[model samples]
Target: MQAAILRDKSGSLKIEEIEIDKPDRNEVLIQTVASGLCHSDLHFIDGSWSDFAMYPMLLGHEAAGVVQAVGEDVVGIEVGDHVITCLSIFCGHCDRCLTGHSYLCSHRQEVSDRPIGKPPRLIDGEGNAVNQFTGLGSFAQEMLVHQNGVVKISPDMPLDRAALIGCGVTTGVGAVFRTAEVKPGSTVAVVGCGGVGISAVQGAHLAGARQIIAVDLESQKLEWATQLGATHTVNPNDGDPVMQVLELTGGGVDYSFECIGMKQTAEQAFGMIRQGGSATIIGMIPIGVNIEVPGTDLFLGAKRLQGSMMGSNNFKVDMPHLCELYLGGRLKLDEMVSRTISLDEINEGFEAMINGEVVRAVIDFGT
Candidate 1:
């Protein structure tokens, strides 16, 4: 199959005909339908963050597809099913999974990839092993993943839109709906108005937030945020975003979500929340950058700063429900798709995202 391979940090992806091994006993093969370009992937692609990712890696996780085949040991999912893939691959018996925190599953590395002795799932034409980013690698025409990594959704859900729910949608919506548990009638502020930010805005609205404030430097994103669910918008160009949010919300917001993954924006999220209110950091901030917060506020104000990983999602349960919301027209997935391109246009898609010219650029492999 043809796939986009990133062989270096801060380099353009090279399209190559790669070899994909057959599914393992616990694997499922999916014909990729659509994959969403996410900022998290950009972190690794642009060299801002690199930890587990290896060279010549396949770099995409936000995706939806039709199941092409499944190994004998794979149950609960069958060929022809529509599903959304997640990086939160879990082992069901782990303490975290048993305790309803599968996102923190202890055996993730153990289960998500092939066993050490096994042949690699993907390889170059010269027969070199290629790493699969996050073990999903949805940037390709097909994805072979552990059964635990994908959640079957209603086939009625469009694959292009379902792709967003895989990462950006799930992370954004989960941050509001599950992690912070924003209560109805509360004031909310979301920093960043990209695909994930817009999802956060919509999630706040769905949770019945009295006022959803969207913050961004781009007027286009602010406008898109308002269209999705932001009751008001704040452009940082106007002035200090924290001060702007404070002026609009009377003092501060009840809940604040930092989705940009920047040190300054993370601090701003903390500042925008009122005393005793919670601030959730949902962005993948660069590794090794320590975030400093006001020490006195912890004792005097009772404010909380927490990090949310993939919205603390249990994909099998959360994704299906998300699909229902989108299918029912409550969640606005249609407006989230700014553009659709073919797999060959992958580089252009990433450029658009880096330029902040799109909300979510989806690569339609079938295109």
Candidate 2:
């Protein structure tokens, strides 16, 4: 199979011919259809949350595709089934899974590269082993993953749209529905207008939030946010987002979401919450970075700050329901995709994301 290999830090991805091992019991092979170029991928490229993301690793995690083959023990899915790839693969027997927090499962990935107890799935022409990013590696033409890493969806749902369900959409909507539980008629603010931020706006709209304030530095993104259902828009370049939101909502909002992973934006999200209100940080801030907040404000105002990972999602349940929401027209999945490119154009897609030119640049692999 042809895969885009992330050779090393600050290097162009080299499209290389690789070999995929056969699926073992509990694993499945998927024909890649669409993959979203997420900011988290950029984090790896730019070296934020460092890990043993082995050299020449296959990149990309947010994806959706068709099931090409299934292992003997795989049940509830079969060949030709449409599916969305979920990075949060969980072992059903884990303590987190049993506790109803499978999204936080400790054993969320395959222990061995081979299915069950086999060999690694990926290797070079010389048989050198390579790593898979987030255990999905949808950047390739095909991927073999644990059955738990994918959720079957309706065939009617477009694979391109379903791709966003894997990460950006799930995280943004999950933050509102599962994390903060935004109530009807509530005032809310989202600090970023990227793929995740825009979805956060749509989630707030679907939740019947009366006043949805979208804040960003880009006019184009704010326009997109308005179309999605933001009742108000603020560009922090003009003035302070906190003050603007307060004036628009008459003293801060009931809930605020920080979709841009920055110290200043995180602080703003925390500081703009109304008394007894909650602020959810949806973006991945750099590790070891610190933001100082007044202790008195937290104590006297009863404000709370919490972090949301992948929208605190239980993928198996949440993803299928998200598909239904998209099918029902309540979710704006299609509008979230600004453009699509081929695998060789992957770098350009990330560049667009960093430049804030697109909500999401999807890699479309047409079979």
Candidate 3:
């Protein structure tokens, strides 16, 4: 199998021929069809989150594919099923999973990875072990992952678009539907108009938000946001984004989402929300960076600032529902994909993402 490996934090991905082991008990082998290049991956590539990087690692998580085989212990999934892989692999017995928050499962490491001392799931030509990022490494032609990490979806769904639901779509839409529980007719503002931010715009639209404001520094992205569903666009280059959002919404929006992982944008999201409103941080801010908010505002206004991990998703149920929405012509996944490239072009894809040149660039493995 050919996979993209990040040997170190040098800000590039190298495509190499690697070997993928057969499925272990409780695991599934997937012939990768499509995978989305996400900002979270860029975080490690660019050294923003360098401390978490495992060198010689296969790096990609948002993916969808056909099941090639399944281990004997895998029950619900079988060969020939179409599925989306999630990073939030969970242990069913964990307190978080039992409490309806499997996305935050505390026991993922216990189940997602192969036991220590066992042969690695991936290996280099010299037989050195290569870590699988988040245990899904969909940038490769094949993915070996735990059964709990995949969600079976209708075969009718297009694999290229279905790949988005694996992460970006799920994270953005799930933030509104599950984490924030955004009410219909609510006023919403989303900072950053990239993949996740654009998805959040679509989520707000589908959730029946009366006013959807899209914020970004790029005019092109704001245009894309408007076409997708944003009622208005805000470019910080013109003026203060927080003030512009406040002026547009009459005071502040009912809910705000920070999709760009910057201390400034996260704080601006807090500023854009009205009293009693909630602000959800979906982007992964670099480790050690702190975001400061006024204590008096939090206390007196009853405002809430919180983080949403992978949209607080329960992929088994939420992913299938998202697929139905896409199939029903309600959710717009086709518009979200800006380009489709092959696995060899992964580095260029990430460069485009860094430049804000595309909403999403997917790698079509042609399986």
lDDT of 2 at 73: 92
Q: What's model 1's lDDT at 322?
A: 93
- What does the lDDT come to for candidate 1? 0.93
The residue ranges of model 1 lying beyond 4 angstroms of the native Cα positions read none
Best by lDDT: 3
lDDT of each: 0.93, 0.89, 0.94
The pairs that clash in candidate 1 are none
How far in Å is the alpha carbon of 160 misplaced in model 2? 0.6
Q: 139 in model 1: Cα distance from truth in Å?
A: 0.8
Candidate 3, residues 2-81, lDDT tens digits: the string is: 99999998899998999988998999999999999999999989988889988898899999999999999998999999
Q: Compute the lDDT for candidate 3.
A: 0.94
The lDDT-based order of candidates, best leading, equals: 3, 1, 2
**Tens digit of per-residue lDDT, candidate 1, span 1-367:** 9999998876578899999888999999999999999997888888887665688899999999999999999999999999999999998898999999999999999878899999999999888988888889988998999999989999899999999999999999999999999999999999999998999999999999999999999999999998898999999999999999999999899999999999999999999999899999999888878789998877799999999999999889999999899888899999999999998999999999999999999999873
Model 1 misses residue 350 by how many Å? 0.6
Scanning candidate 1 in windows of ten residues, the lowest lDDT window is 44-53
Single out the weakest 10-residue window by summed lDDT for candidate 3: 110-119
User: Model 2: which ten-residue window has the lowest total lDDT?
Assistant: 109-118
Q: In terms of TM-score, how similar is model 2 to the real structure? A: 0.97
